[model samples]
Target: MIEVQCQCHGRLNELLPPSRRHRPFTHRLKQVMSLQQLLIPLRVPHPEVDLALINGDSVPLSRNIRNGDRIHLYPDTGDLDDPSLVLLRARPLQRPRFILDVHLGRLARRLRLLGLDTWYRNHMDDRPIIRLARLQGRTILTRDRGLLQQPEVTHGYYMRATSPDRQLHEFLARFEPWPWLNPFSRCSRCNGLIERLPESEVRRRVPPRLYLEFRDFFRCSCCDQIYWQGSHYERLRRYIDRLGV
Candidate 1:
């Protein structure tokens, strides 16, 4: 049998038995076990935890636990009001671009509509999302707390709000990406810049009535999707106004 101690922060102590709060708690285990197994009985949601340290050394959840091992677990820094843990080193980009996870497609579209250079993929796997964020120096916007816990993810924001409109407002209030807003300058379907195209160039693609009605048109260089001012534009404009943009 071996003794283990838990040093938890803030309300995390509530997760422990009443007698263990502000005190060293001991547990006995037979032979050896993995950190994952040890934590299973604690009932702490694994996704909310970001890092675990064993005797001052970082270790993975799958690491084996031995006799007399002391484990310290930490929740995501974003959950804590600690400033020291909040500001990590900025990535290479002067302005942070974003890659939205599968659950945040609506927020991604709203961000792109504001021309914030957001990348969105409904089917992006965790591995590729992390890789893209690292390679492109992009910040990850995800609702899954576990994904933000990855070590490779240096810049990430865990979305707090579930509603798409509230999520956009939350991000804006948190990051203040106002300087990056370009407004209707990007493809809502794709994160590509729209380029001006003469009416004559896309005349065949539009209805004759539309050609006579609207003089301005923009085309996406990446997906070749066309954009023109119409009812959708007015709806989006109203949304932007409601967003206080």
Candidate 2:
């Protein structure tokens, strides 16, 4: 038999039986079971867990549970003190760049607006998303549990929030991007770098009224798309400002 308990973060508490949440309850263990086996079925993947302790000792996801063992799980809180458990973390990244799933176009746009490198396509399929993510050292962002559970995915995030606003807040809270955020620096449409373009250079390219009314202009490095500080720009700036350190 095994006793399972989970931390408050990751919404894992919701998935557990109410009486079992934040507390342990014995369950029959027919055979040895790994941490992945227990949590994956509960919809919490390896990417979301900070640490796992078995029998009051830090253990990895591959650690097998024996009869009469106790288990505890924590979210990515960075408080783990055991040196051995540190290796249990899939791997740390040099930096966080992303490849988002088809349904996350709005979230992709928001991430790119903060100058975070995010690859997104409305028509892209999972195979290609996985391929590009692996080849480019990018993290896969999806709402697909099966995809996140795949063995090949070294880094991924499963979006729990349905609304884009809440999703962004959740993501920002996790990544703590206040230091990295660079607003109005990427194409909201194409995820391309935006740089200042002289007014005279685009004088004839823009509407005459816009050319006269707007002095600040930027162009996308990848798509040659143009941008000016319009209402959308102001709104996004306000959104970024709302995220304080």
Candidate 3:
């Protein structure tokens, strides 16, 4: 049997039961286990995105817990830059791109509306989401804490809110993606860049009344979808304004 002192910090502590927050809890283990496994019993969600320290030395989750060990877990704030601090995940993304899970389609579209590079599909499974995140250097966003626990997902977040708007607020607060927000700059439907198209070029694509009333038009480079400052623009503008962009 082994006895260890475990403590959680920052948002990670929020995942623990109320009794465990802001306090070091004694964890008794009957058998040896990795740091990742230790989190299971502690109810720490999204362990892969968290940093672990043993005796004040940064360590990976794969490190085995020893008897009398003192373990500290922290959220990956991306600001810990001392040479003594070892990063548990890849370097922080300066300009983050995103790949959301199937459950986050609404959030994905909302992110696209803000001109963020958000890749999402209703049919995407967990494997492909992780694969795409790895191959394209996109951050994974999802409500599934289980998916964030996967070892391959180095840059991922578990969304805590249930509603899309609340989730967006939660994400903005956590990731602070405000600097990259360029509203109405991407195709929310296809995750494509929206480019200004000559009115003459898109004249036939839109309705006659729309072409006559709207002077400016945009088109998605990937999906060829046409956009314009139509009647819907006012409502969408109001919506975007509420997003605090």
Q: Higher-lDDT candidate among 1 and 3?
A: 3
Tens-digit per-residue lDDT, 1-245, candidate 2? 44444444445564455766766555654566787776666666676676777777877778776766666677654654655664444676778889999878899998998888899999988888889998989988888877877666778878878889888997887677676678778888888889888767787678889888888887998898988899977887788888652
Report the lDDT tens digits of candidate 3 across residue range 187-234.
989999999987577666878887778788899999999888877878
Worst 10 residues of 1 by lDDT: 83-92
User: lDDT tens digits, residues 1-245, model 1?
Assistant: 65676565544454567786756577777657777567656644343455676777767777888776777776534455643332223333677699999999999999999999899999999889999988987888888766766656667767878999899888998688887898998888989998987657877787788888888888888898988898889998998998878
List the RMSD of every prediction in angstroms: 6.2, 2.9, 2.2
lDDT of 1 at 107: 96
Alpha-carbon runs more than 4 Å astray in model 1? 1-93
Overall local distance difference test of candidate 2:
0.76
Q: How well does candidate 1 score on lDDT at residue 169? A: 87
**Local lDDT at 119 for model 2:** 93
Q: What is the lDDT of residue 197 in candidate 3?
A: 89
lDDT of 1 at 226: 85
Relative to the true structure, candidate 1 reaches a TM of 0.68
